[model samples]
Target: MSKLVEEFNDYRTRMNEVILSKNNLVMKRLWNLDTNTYEEGALDKKTKEMLGLVASMVLRCDDCIKYHLGKSYELGVTTEQMYEIFAVANIVGGTIVIPHTRRAAEYWEELQTNAQ
Candidate 1:
């Protein structure tokens, strides 16, 4: 598994053990209400993912960026397209995405045989 997925799963396991509800409560509320405003809005999936990368960059979420970048590639996002995405990030969010870019590279290096 990608480390991002593993980490997220590990976090989910720990959170399940804690019996404390958090982090996703608000999103859950939205989910349960069937109000996928974000999903239903103007953005398409690939575009949304690109924006997700931008948000991850702004939030300095290295794992998130790594995860999304991999998924982005799987979705046929080209390197040049990613470069364009990076240009957008640089213009709007600046250098915060650098660590995420590095994390994405490392995660790619660590990718196994896709057995997971």
Candidate 2:
């Protein structure tokens, strides 16, 4: 697995364990809902992942960016598609997204390289 994906899975596993152990019905339900929303839908999984990446960039959430970028790559989002996502992030987030966008771009390239 790509390092980012590995990290994300590790984090997800840990978080899921905590939520389940706590018996937090709301948290578990929210997680399930989030997962369902991201699955193939009217917008398609790839587009949703791309949009997730853009939102992650705008939110300056590295973990979110890593997760979404990995998903986007897994869904066969091309470098061109990634660049367009970055453009959207830039437009909506302005300069604040620069660092996040740069990190996401680097992670995206790394994922592509590992796949090759």
- Judging by TM-score against the true structure, name the best candidate: 2
lDDT of 2 by residue, 65-105 (tens): 88888788878888997899999999999999999888887
Per-model TM-score, in order, reads 0.57, 0.88
Tens-digit lDDT track for model 1 on 1-116?
75655776588568655643565776667645532433546776677778877777777777567756766766767667877777777677777667666665556444432433
Alpha-carbon deviation at 46 in model 1, angstroms: 0.9
Candidate maximizing lDDT = 2
Q: What is the lDDT of every predicted structure here?
A: 0.65, 0.86
Clashing residue pairs, backbone N/CA/C < 3 A, model 2: none
Per-candidate total of colliding backbone pairs: 0, 0
State the local distance difference test value for candidate 2. 0.86
TM-score (C-alpha) between model 1 and the true structure: 0.57
CA deviation > 4 Å runs, candidate 2: 2-5
